[model samples]
Target: MIGSPITPQGVIERKRGIGKVEVEVKNMQSDKDREEDMDRLSDLPDFVLLHIMKFMSMKHAVQTCVLSKRWKELWKRLTNLALHSSDFADLAHFSKFLSWVLSNRDSSISLHSLDLRRKGCIDHELLDMIMGYAVSHDVQQLAIEVNLNVKFGFKLHPSIFSCKSLTFLKLSIWAVPWMTELPSSLPLPALKSLHLEHVTLTAGEGDCAEPFSTCHVLNTLVLDRCNLHHGAKFLCICNSNLSSLTIGSTTQETPYKFVLSTPNLRSLSVMRDPIHQLSACDLSFLEQVNIDVEAYFNAHFQRTHLALISLLQVLADYVKTMILSSSTLKILNGLSTSGSMITQIPCFVQLKSLKLKMKSSSSISDEGVSRIVEYLLKKCPLAKVDVINCRE
Candidate 1:
C-alpha cells in the first residue's frame, strides 16, 4: 500500500490543499493535447490544398466542400480537373454534374489540365462540349480516353486544334473504332506532343495531304493501330520539326508504305507488323531506331524480309543505336538458310550500340544466329553488341 500509484483524481482525495495546483496543471496539459488534435488540414494554403485534391476525382474534390466553411469553395480554384464516368450513378448524373461544375467553377483561373475518362458509351457531343470548354479556359494539357462497349465515331471539337495554349494532347479510343478523318488543317503552333490511338486517317478524294503539316512546333508523334482508309494507299507524316516518331500497325496486310518527311528525327519505333516501304528524304540525323515487326513465313515472307532489309539499309548510314526484334531476326535467319543470304549486309558506319532481341520460339539454330551476329560484328567493328533472348 505504501508504493501505490497515484491517479489524478486520487490526488484530489489525499491532499486537498495542493490538489488545486495539480488540477490546474492537468487542465493545462489537456488543453495542449486538444490544440494538437485540432484540424491542421483546414489551415493549409488554398493552392496547397488544391494540389492535394488534384489527384482526386472531381466528384470527391467537390464533396470535400462539405468538410468545413473554409473548404466550401476551394474546389473551384483547382487547376487540374479529372472527371470519370464511373464516379456518378449514371450517364445522366455524370453529364449533369459535369455541366454544373464547368459552369459554376471559377473561370478566372486558367486550367492546367483536363482529364476525362469514360468506360461505357459517351456522347460525342458531350466530349465536344468539354473540349470547347477546355480550349476557352486555355488548358495546357488535355487527355481523353474512352473505352466503349460499342464503336463510336468520335470527332473532337474544331477549337482544340486552334488552341495555342495547349502543349500536350492525347486522344485514345478503344473498341476498334475510327475517329472521323483528321481535319486537313491542324494549326496547333504550341502543341509539342500528340498521341492518337485507333484512329483512321483517310485521303481527300483523289489527293493526299499531310494532316500534321501545320503543327510547326510538334516534336513527338505516336500513331497506334491507326489505319488509312478511303483509298488512301499510304500514310504521309510530313512534319519537319518532328524528332521522335512511332508508327504502329495499319489495318492492311498488303505492302502499305509510310511517306516520312521527318528530316530531324532522332528516334523511331515501328511495332506489331512491318510497313512495306519507308520513303524518307534525308535521315542524316537519325540516331536511335527500334524495329519490332512480325510476319508469318508464308507467301508474304519474301515481302516482309525485303521491307525490313530496306529499312535497315536506309538507317545503316547514320543510326548510332539500333534494336532488332525476335521476329525480324527470325526473318533474316530464314534468308540465310534459304541460300538467299544478302551478299552485302550494309555496314553500320556510326553504329555504337547493337541489340538483337531473340525469342525461344525462334527455331533458327545457334549456328545460324551466330552467322548473322558475326556478319553484323564484322560490318560494325566499333559497336557494342548484346544478344537478349526475350522469350514469349
Candidate 2:
C-alpha cells in the first residue's frame, strides 16, 4: 500500500480501515480501564486502607486477618478501640480478650479514644485496672458505660479527673450510679466536652465550682437523668469557655438548681419533666435557647398542673432568640387554667427573634399574637417575630 500509486478509491479504503482499527483499539482501552477501576480499593495506599479500617469494630478488624498479611497487624495500631461485652461469649472471655488485644497492640502507638460498655455483676476493680491502663496510654477521649449494682455508687479513679490528655469524656454509670468519690477538686486541664448520664452528683464542701474548676477549655457539658444528692441540689458551673449547656431531667420534683455562671454561654437547652424553678439566668452573652416543657403536661403530672408559670417567668428573664411552642403560649396566656400573670411577662431585652410554633388547636389567635408582639416591640423595637405553623 505504501508503494502503490495514489488513487481516490485506494486512499478512501485505506482511511476506513485505519478508522476501524482505531475504534477497536479505543474499545479495548476502555474495557481495560473499567477493570482497573473495579480493582481500585485494592490499589489504595496503606494509610487510606488503615483509615477505612478504623470505622470497623476491633472484632471485625481482627477478622480481616484472613484477607492478607498487610491487614493482620493493622488493627494493632488503631487509634480507637471500642470493646463491648456482647462481642464475646462471656465476661471471662471478654476479660481475656481485652488483655490479649491490649497486650498485643503496638505500645509505641498512642490511643486517641477508648470506649467500654459492659453490663454485668459489679466488677469495679477490674474496670479500674482497665480504665487506668487507658489513661496511662495517652487516650484523649474515653467513654465508659457500666452497671454498678451495689446500693452505693463507685468512685472513679482520680487519674481520670486529673488526666491532662483527655479532651472528651462520657460516663454512663447506671443502677447505683452515684459517684461518691469525685475529687474535691476536678482538674481536667484539657477537657473540652463532657457528658454525664444516670449519675448521682453530690456537692463538696470545697468551692462548689471545684469539680469543674480546672476545665479551662471546656466547651460543652450535658447532664441527663442525673440525680442530685440531698443538700447538694445545685449545679454551679463557672467555666468561662463553656458555650453549650444541655440539661435533661426525666422525673418531676427535680431538686437541682441550674446555676449557670458561664458568662460566655452561647446556647442553652432545657428538657425538663417539671423543673419547679431555675436560678436567675445571667445572659449578658447568651445567644439562643430552646425550652421544651411539653413533658411537663403529661397526664400523670397534669392533675398537679402547676402550669409551669414560674418556669415561664424565669425563661422570659434571659431568653435570647426563642422558639415558642403552642403549649408555651398556652401557659403564657393570662386566662390559662392556672391564671398565669401574663401582665408580668417582661419584654425580652436580649431576644432579637421570636419564633412561634403554632398548632391548629392553638388558643391564641393572630390578634393575640399581635398584641404580644406589640408588647415585645416596646423593648426590642427591631424584633423579628415569625408565626410558623406546627406542621412546618
Candidate 3:
C-alpha cells in the first residue's frame, strides 16, 4: 500500500480521495463563516425596521416572515399598516388575512397610520372592526377609501369620532349615487387635517350637528365634491385655526348657502364650482388665492361672476399670489362693458405674483385677455404676471 510500484489507476484514486477531503473541509469553513455573519436587517432596531417596512406593501412585509426567524415576528410590530382588499384573491381571503394581522400585531405599539383602500364589494363588519382596532390603538392618521354600498347603510365606528390621538382622518367614499349621511358629532379634538370626498355634511338642524365646528384646531380641510345636505339651511365652516382650505365641487348651483368664518386662513383654492351664496368672514390673513372657476361660466355666468367678485373682494387686500382662470378675463371683459363695476374692483395691495391659467376651451381672444390684464395691472402694478396655457 505504501507506493509499491503504484499504477496510474491507484494514483488517480488517491488524488480523488485528497480532493474529496479538501472539498469537505472547505464546505465546513463556509458553513461556519455563514453562521458567524450577522444579518444586517435584523441588526436594525424594531422602530427603524418598521419605518423601513412602511415603504413596502403589507403583503411584502408579511412575506419577510420567510426571510428569518427574527423577521417572522417583526412584521407584527409594524406601526404603519396599509391594507388593500384587492391584494387578496377574494373578500374572504382579505378578511381572514386582516383578522390574522389584527389578532397577532403588537397591540402595545400605537398605530401611526392605517390606510385601507377597498374597491370591490363592501364589508361593513370588517370595516367597523378595523376602525375599532385603529381607534383603540391610538391611530394618528386614518385614511379609508371604499366603494359605498348604499343598501347596507354604511357607517363608521363611533369611536373614530371620539379618538383622542387621531390627528389626520380622510374618508373618501365613491359609487354611491346619493350622499352618505355624516355622524351627528365628530368631536375629534386632536384632528388637524380632514379630507372628505363624495360625503354629505348636514348642517346642525334638530338632532344633527355641524360636522366641522368641533374641529377647532383643524388646519387643512379639503372638500372634494361634497354636498351640504340642507337639513338646516346653511353650512357654516367656522374654524379659526384653518390655514389651508380647498373646495372642489362641480355643481353649478345648490340651494344651501356656505358660510366660512376662518379668520386665520392663509391659503385658499377653489376649483370647478362656485357656491351660490358663499359668505366669508374677514380673510385678512390670506396669502395665496387660486380660483379656477370656469366650469359653469356659460350656463350661470351672472351668478358665478358675482361670486368671483365677492371672492376677490375678500381676498384681494392680503393675497400675495393670485391664480385666475381664463373665464375670469371673459367675465372682466363683460363687466367692463356692462357698468362702472369694473373700476370698483378691489385693488390687490399685497399682490406680488399674478398667474393667468388659460385652458384649451377658453373662448376669450388674445386682445380681450390683454385688456383684462391691463385692468388688473392697474390694480397691482408691481405684481409680476405669468400666463399658463393648459389643455383640458
Candidate 4:
C-alpha cells in the first residue's frame, strides 16, 4: 500500500477533500464574524442602537432589516414615533400605515415623544384614540399641529389636559373651527412649557377658571392668536414659578382683560392684540417688556396713546430693556412736545437698552425720531438707544 501508484479516481477524491477542508475553515471564520456583529456591532449597545433608530423615519428603520438578522426587529421597538399625514398620498394609506405601526410596535416600551402634524381633515375619534394610547404609555413631549382649513375639529379630550407625564405641549391650529374646552382644573403637575396658537376658548363666565392654576412647575407660557370666550371676563395667570410670558391674542371681537400675577416673570411680550385692559401684579422681577400695538389703538390714537404712556410710566422704572414700535414713540413724542400741556417722560432709572422696531416706510421724520432719542437720553442719560427697521 505504501508504494501503490495513485489513480485518477484517488487524485480527484484527494483534491476534493482539500477543497472541503478549506471551505469548512472559511465558513467557521464567517460564522464567528457574524456572531460578533450581531452582538457588538461597532461597539454599540442595544439601547444605543434603539436610540439611533428613534430618530429615523419608520420606513428607514424598517429597511435596517437588510443590514442583518439582529436589526430585523429593532425598529418595532422604537421609542419615538413622529408621523405626519402630509407625507402620504392619501388618507387610506396613511391610516393603514399608522394603524399597522401602532398595533405592531412593542407595547411595553414607553414612548418618549409623539409629534403628529395633521394638515388634512381627520376624524376626531381617530385623534382621541391615538392620544389616548400615547397618554397611557407615559409620553413626555407631545406636539399636535392640526392646521386644517376645514370646519371639523372637536374639543380635546380631558385625558390630554390631565396627563401627569407631559413636560412640553404645543397645540397649533390654523382656520379650523376648534372649540377649545380648557379644563377648569388641569392637573399637569409635570408640565413645564405650554404653547397654544390660533385656538378659540369656549364661552364661560369664570367657568374656565384655574385652567393652568395647578401647573406648579410651568415656566414658559405662550398664547398667540388665541380668541377668548365671550364670557371669559379675565384671562388670569397666577403662576409664581413662571419666568417668561408671550401673549398675542389680537382678536378684538372677544375682549378679555389680561390679569397676570407672575412674580418671577423675566421677559414679557404683548403684541398684535390691542388688549382692552391689562392689570399686572408683582412684576418686581421683570427685566424686559415688548409691546407692539398697531390697529387696535391706532383707531383712536389720542386716548390709546395716553393709556399706553400710563402703562409705560409704571414699567419704565423697573424694566432694563424695552422694544417698542416707532408709532408708540411718535405718540409719546406728541404728548411731550404739545404746547397745550407738556407731558413729562418718566425717568427710566433702570432702563439700559432701548430698541425701536419700525417699518421700512416709516413716516416719522428724522426730527421726530431725534426728539424721542433726545428725550430718552435726557431721562436715561446712561441708556443706549438703537433703531431697527423690521420691514421686509
Predictions in order: lDDT? 0.80, 0.71, 0.79, 0.75
The lDDT of model 2 is: 0.71
Better of 1 and 2 by TM-score: 1
Tens-digit lDDT track of model 4 for 232-290: 66777879999999877544454566677888999988765344566777778998988
For each candidate in turn, the TM-score is: 0.82, 0.75, 0.81, 0.77
Better of 1 and 4 by TM-score: 1
Candidate 3 lDDT by residue in tens digits, 11-79: 999999999999999999998777666555567787887788999878789998998787889998898
Better model by lDDT: candidate 1 vs candidate 4: 1
**TM-score-sorted candidate list, best first:** 1, 3, 4, 2
By lDDT, highest first, what's the ranking?
Answer: 1, 3, 4, 2
lDDT of 1: 0.80
Total clashes in model 4, counting residue pairs 3 or more apart in sequence or in different chains: 1
lDDT of 1 by residue, 144-212 (tens): 887544345545688997899989998886653544545656789899999988666666555454678
User: What tens-digit string does per-residue lDDT give for candidate 2 at 122-182?
Assistant: 4677677777888888899999887765546457776887888999999887764344335
Please say which candidate is ahead in lDDT: 2 or 4: 4
Instruction: Count clashing residue pairs in model 2.
Output: 0
Q: Per-residue lDDT for 239 in model 1?
A: 88
Best by TM-score: 1
